[model samples]
Target: MRRVERALLSVSDKTGLIDFARGLSELGVELISTGGTAKALADAGLPVKNVSDVTGFPEMLEGRVKTLHPMIHGGLLADRSKPEHMSKIAEHGILPIDIVVVNLYPFAATVAKPGVTWEEAIENIDIGGPSMVRSAAKNHAAVAVVVSPSSYDGVLNELLRNDGKLEAETLKRLAGEAFAHTAAYDATIAAYFAKKLGEETESILPAKLTLSFEKAQDLRYGENPHQKAAFYREAQGGQGVASARKLHGKELSFNNIYDLNAAYNLVQEFAGEKDPTAAIIKHTNPCGIAVSTTLADAFTKARAGDPISAFGGILATSRPIDAATAELITGKNTFFEAIIAPGYDEDAFKILTEKKQWGANLILLEAEFGAEAAGENIDIKRVSGGILVQTEDKHAVGRADLTTVTRRGPSDAEIADLLFAWKVVKHVKSNAIVIAKDRQIVGVGAGQMNRVQSVRLAVEQAGDKAKGAALASDAFFPFADGPEAAGIAGVTSIIQPGGSKKDGETTEMADNYNIAMVFTGHRHFRH
Candidate 1:
C-alpha cells in the first residue's frame, strides 16, 4: 500500500467531483485539475492547481491541448518502489500523482444524436484523458486510476478507511476498470469511423472485430442447472432485453433471459403495425402468435394457438398491457414465466401483480420506449474452435415480392393469412412450418428432421382449423410430400421460396389439389 498525496482530476463527467475532492482535501491530498474541472473545484471552495500552472504552459487550441505535458504523465507513471525514480521526479520539481480521476468525452452519446455533424463527433473524442488514464493504469502497482463517476464513493471510502492509502488489490481492480473504460470508448470511436468511412455492403464484416461488454448480472446457473452463467451487456446501444426494467416479480433466470429476449425480438417484428400483436415463445421458438383489433383479443387468440405449450412460456406484446388484456391473461389458470412489453396500464399492473395464482412469481419487464427493433444488425454463433458471423435475417417478403406459381391465385383473405404466416415462419427454427387463419397462428411445426414431417406436425396441430388455413414453409420443399400433406389437411393456400428441382412436382401437386401456391423468392431458414 502507498499513501496517496496527490490526485490528478480531469473529467468530462463531474458527477461526484466536489464531494470526492473535499474528502481528499480532508486527507491532506493535493488536487490537480484542468479547464472546466479546475474551475468547478475552485467554485466549490476547494483548493485546486490547474494543469497549465503546474506545467507552466497555457491550454491552447480551444482547450484541446490541456494536460498533455510530461509534468502530468511523469507524475502518474513514476515508480515509488525505486528510490531513484522518486528522487529524479523530486529533482525536477515534479510531485508524483498517486491517483488519476478521469472519464473520457462522450463520443458514443454525441454520435448517437440526431443530425450530429462529423465535425462534432470528431471533436468529442478525447485524446489527453485516455492518455492520462492509460499512464496511471499501466503503473497501477503504485498509482490508482478512477475512470467513472460511480467509482467515486467507493474509492473515497477506501481512501478514508486506510488513511489516504489504497491496497494493492484495490489498485489492480481500478486499473482493470480503467483499461476497460478506455477500450469501450475507443471501440465506439472505431465503429463510428467505420460507418462514416462508408464500407461497402459487400465488405460488411471488418478485418478485425473488437467487442466490449460489461457484466450486467450473475445468474444462478446457465442453460442447465449445473452450468455457470452471467449476463454481459454491450457497452453501446444499451437497449432491448439488456436494458429492460423489471417492474415486478422474482429475478430473471438464465433461461428466462433467453426466452424474454426471443419474445422481445419477435414482438419488435410487428412494431408500429395497425393491429395489436402478441407472441408466446417456448424454448426460443414462438408457439403462438396473433395480431388482432384489441390487445386482449390478440393475447387470447395467440394463447389459443397452443395453450399447452404456452403454459409457463414467455409472452410478449407490441403495445402496453391494458386492463382488459391483463384480465384476459390471468383469466385462465395457465401461468406464464414472464411478460415483456412497452409498458403496463395502472389497472393492468395492479391486476397482474395481485393475481390469485402465480402472480407473485411472474416476471414483468417494461421496455418503456419504442422498443423499436433488435440491436446490432448482425448474428454471431459460437462454434467448436472459432465463431460464425452473418448479417441478421431481417428480410421480409412483401406482397410485391410474391409470384403465383399454381393455376389458382390465393383469395384476398388467404393472401393476408399467407403474409402473416410468412412472418411467423421466419422466426421459427429450420424446417419450420406455420399454419395461420385470420391472422392467428393455429399451429407451428419447427425444427423437424424433414420438411414433410414439419408439414404433417403442423397439420395435426391445427386439426379442424387446418381445413381453410394458409401454410408457410420457411424454405422450398424438396419433395411433394409436404404439399401433399397440406392438401390432405385441407390447406387452401401455401407460400414458399420455390427453388428446388422438384418444384415442378410440388407445383403439379398444388394444382391437382386446388391449393393456391405462391413463391416468395426468399428463403428464411433459422437454425
Candidate 2:
C-alpha cells in the first residue's frame, strides 16, 4: 500500500469535488488544483493551492499551458522506489503527487448538439488532461489516478478503510480504466473527422477503425451448452436488434439473436406498404413471409407456406399484434421460439402468456419498424485474422431498373409477384430461390450449394402453386439449368441479376419455355 500525501485535481465535471477534497484535507493531504476547480474548492472552505504556485508559471493561452510543466509531470511520473528518481526530484524541489484526479472535456456531447461549429469542436479536444492521466497511469505502481466521478465513492471507501492509503491492485484497476477512457475519447474524435471527410471522398472506410462495445449481459451458453458467451452493445446507439426491449421470455440465446435479426429485417422490407407484413425465420433464413390486409391473414399465410419449418422459429411482424393474430400463432401444434412486433394489444398479450405452455418460455421483443433505411450504416464481418467492413445492402430494385430479357414480358400480376419475391430473396442466404404468388411466399430454398438445387427445392415445395408463381434468385445463374428447372416447374416469370457470361443462353431458354424474365442490374448475395 502507498500512502497519499499530496494530490492534484483538475476536472471539467466537478461533481463530488468539494466533499472529496474535504475528505482528503481532513486526512492531512495537501490539495492542489487549477482554474475553476481551485476557486470552487476554496469557496467550499477547503484550503487549495493553485497549480501556478507550484510551477512558478501562470496559465497562458487561455488556460491551455497551465499543467504542461515539469513540476506537475515529474511529480506524477516519478518512481518512488528508485533512489536516482527520488534524488533527482529532491534536487529540483519537486514533491511527488500521489493522487491525480482528472476528467477530460466532453468533446462527444459538445459535437452531438445541433449546429456545433468546427471551431468549437476543435477547441474542446483535451491535451493536458490526457497527458496527466497517462503519466499517472504509467507510474501506477506509485500513483493512483481517478478519471470518473462514479469511482469517487469507491476510492473514498478504500482510503477510509486503509487509513489514507490505497493498495496496488486498486491503483492498477483505476489505471486500466483511465487508459480506456482516453482511448474512447480519441476514437470519438477520429470517427467524427472520418465521417466528415468520408462523404467528400466517397470512401466510407477509415484509415484507422476504432470500435468499443460495452458488455450488456452474460448468457447461459453460446450456440451450444458447452461454449461460454456474452452480449455486447455498441458504444454509439443506433436502430437495430441491440436496441430492442424484451417484454417477456427466457433469456435470449446466441441463436435466438441471429434468427430474430433475420426475421425483423425481412419484415422491415415491406415497411412502406399499407398492408401488414409477417416473416418466420429459422437458422438465420426466412422460411416464409407474406403481406396481407390484416395481421391475422399475414401470419396465417406466412405460416402456411412452410408449417414444419415454422415450428420452433422466430416470428416478426410490421404491425402491432392483435388478439386474432396472437391466437393463430398459438394454435395447437404451433410452437415459436420468439415473436417480435411493434406493440402488443393488452388482450393479445394476456392470452399468449396465460393460456399456452410455450408462451411461458417464448421470447417477446418490441421494436420500432419503418423508421428509416439502413443504407447509411456500415456492416462488419469477422474472419480468421481481420474484419471486413462494407456498406449495408440496402439497394432495392425499382420499376425502371428492371429490363425485360425474353420475348414474353411479365404481365401486371406477374410483375407484382416478382417484385415481392425479389424483396424476400434479398434477405435469404446465397444461392437462394423464392417462389411467390399474389403477395405471399409459396416456397423458399435458402443457403443451397448450387442454384439448380435451390430452384428444385422451392419448386418441389410449391407443388401446384408453382404453376403461375414468380421466382426470384439472389444472384445471376452461372448456367441455364436454374431457369430450365423453373420452366419445368411451370414458373411464369423470373427476376435475377443478369451479369453471368451465359446470360444470352438463359434468355433464349426462357423464350423457348414461354417464361418472362427481368434483369435487376444489382445482386444481393448474403452469406
Candidate 1 error regions (>4 Å):
198-203, 368-376
| Candidate 2, superposed: residue stretches over 4 Å from native | 6-71, 87-95, 108-124, 148-154, 373-375
Worst 10 residues of 2 by lDDT: 370-379
Tell me the lDDT of model 1 at 80.
81
Error of 2 at 367 (Å): 2.7
Worst 10 residues of 1 by lDDT: 368-377
Model 2 per-residue lDDT tens digits across residues 31-94: 9999999999999999999999999999999988999999999999889989999999999999
Best by TM-score: 1
Q: Per-residue error at 313 for model 1, in Å?
A: 1.0
Q: After superposition, how far is residue 328 of candidate 1 from its true place, in Å?
A: 1.0
